[model samples]
Target: MEMLTLECPYCGVQADETELHAGGEAHLTRFGPGSSDADFEAYLFMRENPKGVHFERWRHVNGCGKWFHAARCTMTLEVFGTYPAQTAEPPKKIRDAITAKRPGWTWRELS
Candidate 1:
């Protein structure tokens, strides 16, 4: 199996893929009880899987055991930046970098 590495923003640890776990798309707002069926459904299954800049969640499972968010390009597989998982939106620096690389990119607070 090919090996990969992801840096943990919280602990500053560089861990191999085996030491990390993917948590899926990041910055997802929870659709709790009482949410409309449509909202729940969207939360359960909807994802852009966008071809360009994408935000994702990951954990340093075998290392710091902390979760963090990563902004990466789905096409090029290049990571633009990583930030704490608790953040509700992409950091400004990361957004700027993405804009610089992918001109005319639209950034959404909840996408």
Candidate 2:
């Protein structure tokens, strides 16, 4: 049987690809509603041409429904780290709001 290797960022596990799912290219950030034609063209056609240190968004499609981030060296196919999907900047505002609501909760204390 052919086996593919994948590294899980959330749990810091490196296992067969059967345990994960490739969620397609990760560089698709948001575009404003008023973006011009060039913006649309770039979003649709130009993204994720990486040689090294690429941040990819993937899901533990088989193990967990949660999405996570992966830092990979594309040239050598080496995965550096994986972190929970919430770590991606898209959720920063929400995370900040939640953090702000938690009175007297310091990051140092949590750690």
Best by lDDT: 1
> What is the C-alpha lDDT profile of model 2 across 1-111, one tens digit per residue?
545466665655665666777775554655668899888787777756556545567777777456776655566665545556654342344334434544342221120
lDDT over C-alpha atoms for residue 31 of model 1: 100
Candidate number achieving the greatest TM-score relative to the actual structure: 1
Candidate 1: count of backbone clashes, pairs at least 3 residues apart or interchain: 0
Q: After superposition, which runs of candidate 1 have C-alpha atoms over 4 Å from their true positions?
A: 1-4, 107-111
On the 0 to 100 scale, the lDDT of residue 11 in model 2 is: 59
Q: What do the candidate models score in CA lDDT, each in turn?
A: 0.82, 0.57
Clashing pairs in 1: none
Q: After superposition, which runs of candidate 2 have C-alpha atoms over 4 Å from their true positions?
A: 1-13, 88-111
Residue-by-residue lDDT tens digits, candidate 1, 4-100: 5677998988777788899998887789899999999989998767887888899899988999988888777777888898788998898888888
